[model samples]
Target: MRRPAHLTQGRYAPPVPRRTLDVTSADGSRLYAEVHGPEGAPTVVLSHGWTCSTAFWAPVVRDLADTHQVVLYDQRGHGRSPAVPPAGHSTRALADDLVAVLEQTLAPGERAVIGGHSMGGMTIMAAAERPELRARAAAALLCSTGSADLASEARVFPLPTPGGRRQAHRRLLGSRAPLGPVSPPAKWALRYATLGAGASAEQIEACARIVHACPPGVRFRWGHVLYELQLTRSVSRLEVPTAVLVGTADRLTPVVHARRLASVLPQCVGLTELPGLGHMTPIEDPDAVAGRLRDLVRDHLATAPAPRGERPARQKKEKTA
Candidate 1:
């Protein structure tokens, strides 16, 4: 169902899924997944970043679900997905969760265009060599992410010295401090660190709600993953045709990260840097992100017919449990 309220420019209301399911990851983590749009349509599977959930993808889903089947899932401890044990918060876990979602949601042997933002993009890089990713990803969209130097490259705190900046950003990345509430100060902080100066209040509120809802422990653990992330070698393993996008004013993962990603990806298709945008590229500018996905579908998925969500004889719908 369309949300008329979020339909207005720069507004973000969570999209209602046509169907929902639980996907079990390799380590027995259960992820909440949703499917939207019509049957027999081009499919896109979107993964949100750290401290964000399926709701983080709402605007892009709303934009594309009118014509493309959109798949979204909560990261292990976000949204309806339950929190994991101590060792369950690594990038490997992120990859495992993505593989499970793709396997469960798509019909057997069916593939879709995959997109990731921030930590989600790192998840794609982490899963680069997975058989599931190699098999199921037709193309990829890596948005507002950095494969390496996340802590050192971030400009959120902006300390004077590079050494001091690294230490400061490292602390910021791995901090376990709770975000008490989505107050005005909190919104301002979140907006300043994540969004560009031009971001509207509605966009800030939408993102704050999702990011603040993340469990502190979950956020802490994933924050550590990002802090220690090193995936330059893995970028080449993402052999599929891939496009990258970033915002010019992105403080978390800057345009330099996007440039590095574009240079290393084996089949890098294109990289578009949006001016005056931030780390929340899809939310701050959904149309641009959705347009890139459409381009991927047109380029790579044009020959593959969309699979009906059914089997041959009994005509039963595909099982996504």
Candidate 2:
């Protein structure tokens, strides 16, 4: 599960400038991240899913920087964080690291409003285990992600063949090399296979580049891990105000999973069902995702007054059509 040398650093940095912070993980691995927005505002820590880095949040981050302090990081084995021994990577361990990052990065008594896209969402939900950190945050947004029983390999992408998961996992562990450099043909195949018919060529090309560039080893190992996870039990434990958003057309982590999670979360206040969208809702429609996040922030602010000594903060008003 250690990151192979090639994909350890992101092939592309986010196209925006933000403050970079380095945190030394418990085992001495260096985890790096970028912060956006006014330093005094409540921090919104955005965690990317498996096989993704902070760069994946670029679109959503771009829209919210003005109103909320945002922190985005590559999870261990994904972006700038040095890969761990594959055995060291687990949902709980990642969740523990999240608490550390939140404690170190934010001012005393300030809790982050956490959001995660896929496995990223799983990590946040799992963070509920840390009572101190969980109590500091205002709300949580689980987007295009779900809990354990709600999640399945079939729900993520088309089910890999029997043992497909194992092969991908082995390849990622560096036991074998990837099929080859992601090529134009492979890109097209992915779009057709995952996007369903009529998916745009431009979208396909862009996604292909990102996938192609990812560390083949990281991609394979994480893919297997995702297949084996059951995050529903974790979702049931999140006590903070929570919201769920899902694309109607998501082939991976489909809306059904979102629906199931919304039913179990005691604090879930909103469920957004975006029609005609797929798994990449946050990236595919930044404005739509931002609007929902803005609403969640506002609701959390309204219901619970800010903690004493916390900085004065406000959510941006979404523009009326």
Candidate 3:
């Protein structure tokens, strides 16, 4: 398999986690999770996209860990997380894993600003209505993801007909082919499909390494799930303040998906469209992604009111008095 130069050189390595643990999901899958920064700080939990690992969020994590307790995790079968059985692959599984991570990582009554990229965003949507999510998530950022019609809307194939494009995307998603080598042509293809025209060598290398590290079988399984995704109801159920971000040139989950999400989300805080960027918005513009996350942490997560079901300890004590 072809690996990126940075993977060997450690140029864009993920920040060392203060602690690492295996979080057991509802179905008994052990997800690899890491926590960074000081305890008791406002928390930010991040989920990565399809065919990507926790390392994919390195740039953003590096920026956030200075002031926020940043949590990063690999999806089942990706990164340090071991491959799960075939039956364990689905949007529902994604939701279950996310809930487990939140439950295992946070202290009681503490909440986080959760950010998901691509498939990770879909995971948030899948868990939107769950009591665990509502209790643990103060705010959310959905990046480069859609609720449905993924294959139909993706611009990966420049075919003339919509049917042709959709068919091509489906085949591509279902393919178990390995990304064999990171040659110049391979990098070019990666850039065309995922990144902006302006992505630097280092950014491309970082993204390439993370993506290529994913096992082909695992990629095929998750890609098939994405191809058939339908989480519109989940998006509607996401009651927390949410922000949407997408690149104008995104081929995977286009700007239209972002627009639809903003329209349907009950409490959408904002939609940010980055011009000329592609599906890999976080890597394409790490500063912008990190800045938006910081804004959400400051404006929403940090000051979010306590859950309606729970009274403050002082208030409860006064009531007893």
Candidate 4:
């Protein structure tokens, strides 16, 4: 997807990557991946959610780049990556593309703390049992995602009857409706459906542009997959030090998902529910998300050296104590 200049400029402007790679997935679809920060530092690979690109991680990357080598990739049919190939959109394809990204970007035998937001989190869970993910994932951060009953549980529309809600949500999920330009009404709808009440105009606009940039066909395909998603078994198989985070006000994937995941994750380190943030956690509260990641790297990846500038106390001290 080609993003407009204003949408990718200013505070959310993507960090200049150290290198960008055109990764080929198992089915021969090309994936776009960018590596940022320093080489040889403790690595962290970030996967953006549905309807987002590497640009979604701009704030988080800006915060983490000083001490961490950050990697960002666009999922199939999103961002600069070519549209989905003939293999079709499925959880398996998500898993395959993630594996392909790791295989291409990481040095052999090198592991990194991996993190995902929303569908990106599902990508990690979907790839839980894969040997490649198992080999290269030192830890994981699951932010605002669910493994099962996603359409049923989502609070986006808040319909009255159970059957009606499910039906309505399904239609909303797989509607193939075109999201027009980021107009004020479009921002209002996006804000109501996806973001928290406290979202600023800038945050809403940034999210609106990204969400609108996604092709309706691509959105429809992924939406259908999510509508029928069944990944509870996979969540149990994500046997790594994993932390789950969610926005209490998230309409898309509520805190219930985070709670369920916390209960099921094999080695859950923590579950954070931000009081008023929404589904766009990375963009809304980049500092908190980035801070949690820093904690994970310090606690789980201390053996791996950081770049020269960052001091140890900076990494360890929650000194605002």
Candidate 5:
């Protein structure tokens, strides 16, 4: 798919990383990771959604990199990350990969406000109970994701009956069909399924470029996992302050999923609903997504108690005086 001219440059293009590395997951999958912003600044790690690479976070990264240490990683089988064995496609692998990134990137006793979109959000939920997550993550932002009922609640398929819709979506998800070049028709279809009605040509093209870049086999592998996703228990186990964001027009995982997440999350902060946006919340409204992340950083990470064995800046100044 030919991207629009604007998308070829500016915020649509992937941000330049200060450092890049490969993080090896517990299952031996190597995840591609990029670090941005000043060293030792408050950190924020972002996990992109299914069929999306770290590039999908360009806008948000641009907004935050000046002040925060922003870390972006490609999920297994997505972006620069190599495809993993079929056994590594489960939610447990997602958790393992997240922990690996946290352990490798963050300084000892440091914590970050983590943000995930779609499948990335599922990654956070899957890792909620992990000691690594608890130690390194102070807060979380879950965007346009569902804990369960993905296929049954998806607005695609247009079938009148729930069972019919679920069955149709399951088949569609499992299909290994190639997504050919991004033509006008393909853009329209993508917009209908993922973005809001007012999505601009640039936004559609940006989404298309990232989504189409995903390998068909990898897409199908993750799609099958999503088809059978059941992570409500995981969501409940998230003990840190967490906020949920979703679009009212979201077709894949609708507003209901956000409401459910808000209700079930152990430390539910709040749910922000954006009218007219679809499943691609971050791309559809980058400002809103960035704003929420900033809020989490300010409220949770910034004011968090300094890690053990580390002295707060103010305390050190007082001692010197």
Candidate 6:
């Protein structure tokens, strides 16, 4: 794992100590990823949502490391990756970055089971639209994300009215108060506001620290894109089998959105709706998410016929040469 040099001297640092793997972006920008578990096992790539880094997936990573290879990266413009000059920050660009990581770290010709939480899921869906990535994927886990036109599905802070959304975006973009590396107070606010809403005091405090330690610029700029973003169109073209996992209580990406995605996806197999889980399904219920992911992976692997040895069902009676 490699660490980007910019992160060390930047305004924010990750609250928890994280291992780093150096990777390059589609445009050759240096990117860093935190990798866990054995390298030879089946690979599972974990992607985090907006305003978050790889640390958000720590719980799930811990649970899956023993059985699978887990790779987590801070998306470009977040975590340890250097924020480029607005040149490589679009949804498609982020999708390309994900491919770069897979090509560089994972073995050649290997297909991986990819899971993205929230915006992370959207990134993977966008990646799936790419022919190169779609061909290399064993399966896809779309967790807590939805497709095109999300005005009704997600909550846009400050509202998307005529001036409200733009005002909010300007505030977030220009205000060093929010993006100039979070202060402890700001971190606490974020914890209560997002990550640890109903969690224990200890958990809330821990989350606050993590939130506070995030880079301000990353949070500010990325939050704007996520709030105003939608990915439904790109995902409709995805070629691999997909598993849609949604928490029943998710207010951000509601169950209706998940249902729609499942209905439209060509390869949707497991559409598991967990009771009482919320937007941050992995963080809110790591075990449950892990269980469903494991089951989905196993089911796909088990049901899929072997390519070289097994005959197609229609041609089963034919003799082998």
Q: Highest lDDT, which number?
A: 5
What tens digits encode model 6's per-residue C-alpha lDDT throughout 105-145? 67666666788887888888777667667656777888988
- Order of quality (TM-score): 4, 5, 3, 1, 2, 6
Q: Candidate 2 regions off by >4 Å?
A: 1-13, 149-182, 193-202, 302-321
Off by over 4 Å in 6: 1-19, 156-176, 179-198, 302-321
The segments of candidate 3 whose C-alpha lies over 4 angstroms from its true place after superposition are 1-11, 303-321
Model 3, residue 228: distance off in Å is: 0.6
For candidate 6, give the lDDT.
0.65
Candidate 4, overall lDDT?
0.86
- Give the C-alpha miss distance for residue 138 in model 3, angstroms: 0.4
Task: Report, for all candidates in order, the number of backbone clashes.
Answer: 0, 8, 0, 1, 1, 8
- Candidate lDDT values, in order: 0.86, 0.67, 0.86, 0.86, 0.87, 0.65
Q: Which lDDT tens digits does candidate 1 get at residues 6-25?
A: 22344487767999999999
Q: All candidates: CA RMSD in angstroms?
A: 5.1, 6.7, 5.4, 4.4, 4.9, 7.8
Write down the TM-score for model 6.
0.77
Give the per-residue lDDT digits (tens) of candidate 5, residues 1-321: 454322558777887899999998887789999998776667899999999999899999888877677899999999999998888899999999999999988877778889999999999999999988988888899999999989888897778888888998999789899998888998898899999999988899999888888899999999999999999999999999999999999998899999999999989889999999999988889999989998988787644334433433421111100
TM-score, candidate number 5? 0.92
Report the candidate with higher TM-score, 4 versus 6: 4
Report the lDDT tens digits of candidate 4 across residue range 87-196.
Answer: 46999999999999999998767778899999999999999999889888888999888998888788887877766667878998898889987888999999998888
RMSD of 4: 4.4
- Evaluate residue 218 in candidate 3 and report its C-alpha lDDT on the 0 to 100 scale: 100
> Positional deviation of 143 in candidate 6, in angstroms?
1.4
lDDT by residue (tens digit), candidate 3, 1-321: 433423544536877799999999998899999998766566889999999999888889777776677899999999999999888999999999999999999886678889999999999999998999988887899999999988888898978877888899999899999987667888888889999888888888888878877899999999899888999999999999899999999998889999999999999999999999999988888888889888987776544323333333311100100
Better of 1 and 4 by TM-score: 4
Query: Where is the poorest 10-residue window by lDDT in model 1?
Result: 312-321
- Ranked by lDDT, the better of candidates 3 and 5 is 5
N/CA/C clash count, model 5: 1
Count: clashes, candidate 6: 8
